[model samples]
Target: MGTLKNQVQLIGHVGQEPQVTVLENGKKVAKISLATNENYRDSKGEKQTNTDWHQLVAWGKIASLIEEYVFTGKEIAVQGKLTSRSYEDKEGVKRYVTEVIVSEILFLGGNGK
Candidate 1:
């Protein structure tokens, strides 16, 4: 391709602890929910905060690191790309979802502990 695209960056708090699953091929995948907050003043001169939740997936070394030090409420910055897929449910219903596949994760706040 002439130019690169499909990149995303997010700085947010970990909504929950990473859930790790081992694939049949022995590769581990970690899934977590991240919450990004937006703050602004409303029309009535009141502050409002809005939170958006994002799905994040990490594999291999990143997964390992997430399991080691990451936790619920921890702030992190991630560089990744957005991905979406569809799958059939048990009732033959199609379910669609989107996620961010993180390549790099930086721990933030409180000396990154």
Candidate 2:
């Protein structure tokens, strides 16, 4: 079988303030959580809701834009691919995390001021 591809696209609200950091090589990285909610009626005729949160990572120019304009509750659309990495925690236990590596980002709604 052919190798599988990993890609993701999401339009949602920022869950918290974006965290920006600059690397030694002068590259910038921004990290944030995005929340997407769904509304519907349950089989019992009552309203139901679901919210999904995703980890988003932006680099370089995109990181700069996110650092400048993104904030909690702001809406945004992100196009990116999934990435996973392993790291050792404080106790030396290995841990794994998956995040979306942003290739494009679009701010939605009014400009943040």
* CA deviation > 4 Å runs, candidate 1: 1-4, 111-113
> Taking the tens digit of each residue's C-alpha lDDT, what string does model 1 give over 1-113?
65568888999999988999889999989999999999999999999999999999999999999988899999999999999999999999999999999999999985545
Error of 2 at 53 (Å): 0.7
Model 2 per-residue lDDT tens digits across residues 76-96: 999999999999999999999
lDDT of each: 0.94, 0.94
Clashing pairs in 1: none
**TM-score to true structure, per model:** 0.91, 0.89
Show the lowest summed lDDT stretch of 10 residues, model 1.
Answer: 104-113
- For model 1 the TM-score comes to 0.91
Our tally of clashes for model 2 stands at 0
